[model samples]
Target: MAKIAFILLCHKDPDAVINQAQSLTAVGDCMSIHFDARAPRAQFDTIRDALKTNPNVTFATRRVKCGWGEWSLVQATLHALHAAVAQFPDATHFYMLSGDCMAIKPAQYVHDFLDRRDVDHIESFDYLTSDWIKTGWREERLVYRHWFNERTQKKRFYAMFELQKRLGLTRAIPGDITVMIGSQWWCLRRQTVESILEFRKQRPDVMRFFRTTWIPDETFFQTLVRHLVPERDIDSRTLTFLMFTDYGMPVTFHNDHYDLLLSQDFLFARKISAEAHDLRRRLGVLYACEGARFRISNEGRSLFTFLTGKGRTGHRFAPRFWETESTLGRERDLLIVLCRKWHVARRLVDCIRTSTGLPCIGYLFNDESCALPDLGGIQDSMDKRHRHRRALLRMLYEHYDSDRLLICLDPSNLDLIEDFCRDRSVTRLLEIDCDFSDRDLIEHAMRVGLAGDGTPPETLARLLPTIRNDMALETDTLRDRNFAHHSRLREADPPARNARAIAAFLDCSEPIAGALATTDQLFAE
Candidate 1:
């Protein structure tokens, strides 16, 4: 088979991409990469070093900012494509790839698909025909995002839908605002890629639109291919969709279908077990693993999507997926508890053994519940004596007695944690004060799934702690337009000199944090 070129777009994905590159190399594909120029030089240096050992790998000297709804990412792709064409002029086919995508099918199948492919058969070009622009489409399509944000999105959506409807789009008798997924992963015959690049050189307008469109890469590649060759051998149905509802890897069971896909090198998947031995133990699984990726469990895979990079794409491939027969059976889970809020329960819980020396898990809901949605309209006035205890329920059944859980607490909500520890068989509880670690909002934004709606002083307390800066507790809240003021314990405010620390050891802004002392400025003893 002639050589296939892999164009991998990435940022902070060295490990996964490198591993997949290992697989591709084993299967024999020449690789080129475009690392985001926006990343600090250190990242590129590391990536270049990691792949320096690969003979067929080429690194781009030109890097660009890969914006989400902007033309930047498109420019980078074209630039890389130009570079890849120069280096591998003899390469027969080009496969656009991403750090997150792994090829589970045998290379021969892909090679065969490309060998029969013609230069005319691609999606992106035909959409650019002379008739296309006459349909009131030009660089305006690049500004499609104006239809996405603030003022004009709703109007633009209906207008565009009406226009497409007016165009007699066959895919929908009604109108479905459909666009190809993305060129983050696509395959093109070498001649076709060359022609597209040549076309790009000739038509500055086409190229400009590609550069500025919110989703340029996908549109450029797919639109051209579809435009030029609507009759191409695109296996739209052959593309498989996988969802890993299990843990690590599939339980080995001999079945002919599985064997056939493995033998023929087609994509078929089974259930797997996903487990992490270090800090948390997520044993067994509730679903199946399709590819060597995707970690699925009883919690299903939605909550774990971001952690594992499961995008909106319909196809899935979890190479490490497996199935488990639960002795526990199909049962619903209930409740979660936080163990550092209540002092009555806090005194009963050995605060020495939680948080620092121990892994004290916690939950807190303070300030107000006016924000929470309710099922029964249950409230302080809903029951007798105007009392309805509204609260969040957290359940912890798997208890590790020997392991200590140091719980950092919010002073105002101390009762929640203390009560939880008292009810559960906890080995020990060490409560620490807050530290207020909010300086790194870049990473925080992604982990917390912020709506990006410009809500100030957003309460991100529920976000996973792995990515959270402990700063929920401190900062000047006396008056700020971004967020409302919180109680002292939640703000990481330092205690008065000679004042007792009320929360976790790291609670104070500076000095000794979470050090236990009485209100008298001395040990209770």
Candidate 2:
């Protein structure tokens, strides 16, 4: 079995660091941890004692006095990486992680993904040509030599850096090297790490140059890897997820972000705040459940099940609908209705909002006539297509306040919805039923100006049944598990029926239900 050397950088938040380390016990035998030397000794001792029993864990003997934007941060990571390589020389890969980051997927899943691949997973982009610099992000970090007091005048120095950029008096950018900047999170092959260490030894000038640059940690490894690794072998996508807020800081993951986080295909997620103990505990529990799924091994059979649940039959499918209705009844302003039919979804959204006076937003998949561009290619595997779709939706969902938002995505994306609902206490999921026959629906869709222009008739003939079958399978599974809170509304159902369903889901009073009924009747006329 191939092993991974985890290089974990931590500062404060000892419990979160320790919890992250404990979760990796199943996948790897070794970890190298380095805490900021500037942190209090008491905290360091607490972390040391917590992991003392783990014989495979090693602490960096020469920890750097790390400071943000200083070379010390890079030095601390290097020290940990060196320690990790020395302790676990045979480990095939090195994963750079932080105390705030936790594995969102099963440890085994991450391990398998890395072990099967020879390519290095490092996120990088050319600084000058990248949209980031064009969009005015981190532009002055490299072009200006910034100096600041670690304690007092950090913001003052930042202002000076901006002033220099505005005046176009920026210092000379090194012409010898192509500057690559991106997220610091990376997973490198052992040979790649060794190559980096060799480069550091031979090119002290580059190190000296980067040492004076602001936020060198983000650009240093990325730039070096670009020069060392072949372009084809470098997969410039990090497996770690970081949600950046509008304020230019990472948004801390909380309980509400649970569903959104699971929707991502990334292995790790970061910025779980120290104050959120419940969220941390919930993450631990969720990780354990995901880890169990990965531990099941029956050669090709388990792999099939892992990816598509091919051989996993015989398990009873039961959805616990209405299980969280009472809890949801306390306070929930959003009702998500997901259906493929836009006209039906629009009506459902209107009914919910008019009946309950609650804010509702609905996202309908593109109608057949207006199919999505072949962004993922026609031959892309189902899994890859699903991942691409989920990533796009995850970005969209970020705009909504998860607390105040009721999300209703189309049923075509139910796999994503089911995964999202796993960690969330949604008030209710309204599955809208489509009643038209395939031939009749296509004819109606064409007449209604919703038919796809690009999709051939034969393709639509095949695609519609597949979509219907998938929705049916998903409905059956969700209904079995979430029967209590799960309710269905037929497209041809009476307007009163729609009103009652909407009112019931929103947990509104009898008066609101009557109002919805009246509104539905008025709309029908």
Query: RMSD to native for every prediction?
Result: 20.6, 17.2
For all candidates, the clash counts are 96, 19
- Tens-digit per-residue lDDT, 1-525, candidate 2: 557778899888787778877777544547899999888999989989999998678888687787777888888889898888888878888888888877766656677777777888988899877775435546567767666634457688768777877888776666677889888899998999999989999998888778878778779999999988898889998888875543576767776555445445577888877776777777666655644432211122121122243224343233334322222222333356666566666665676566544545555233333223344352134444343543433333344433444555666454456544543335466776676578655654444333433334443464466445655775676666663456666657775786677567667776676565454433221
Q: What's the C-alpha lDDT at position 346 in model 2? A: 67
Q: Kindly report which residue stretches of model 1 are placed more than 4 angstroms away from their true locations once superposed.
A: 116-184, 229-525
Give candidate 2 misplaced runs (Cα > 4 Å): 133-139, 149-151, 155-171, 256-259, 285-525
Give lDDT for model 1: 0.42
Whole-model lDDT for model 2 versus the true structure? 0.66
Per-residue lDDT value at 518 in model 1? 24
Candidates' C-alpha lDDT: 0.42, 0.66
Ten residues in a row with the worst lDDT in model 2? 295-304
**Please, what is the TM-score per model?**
0.39, 0.56
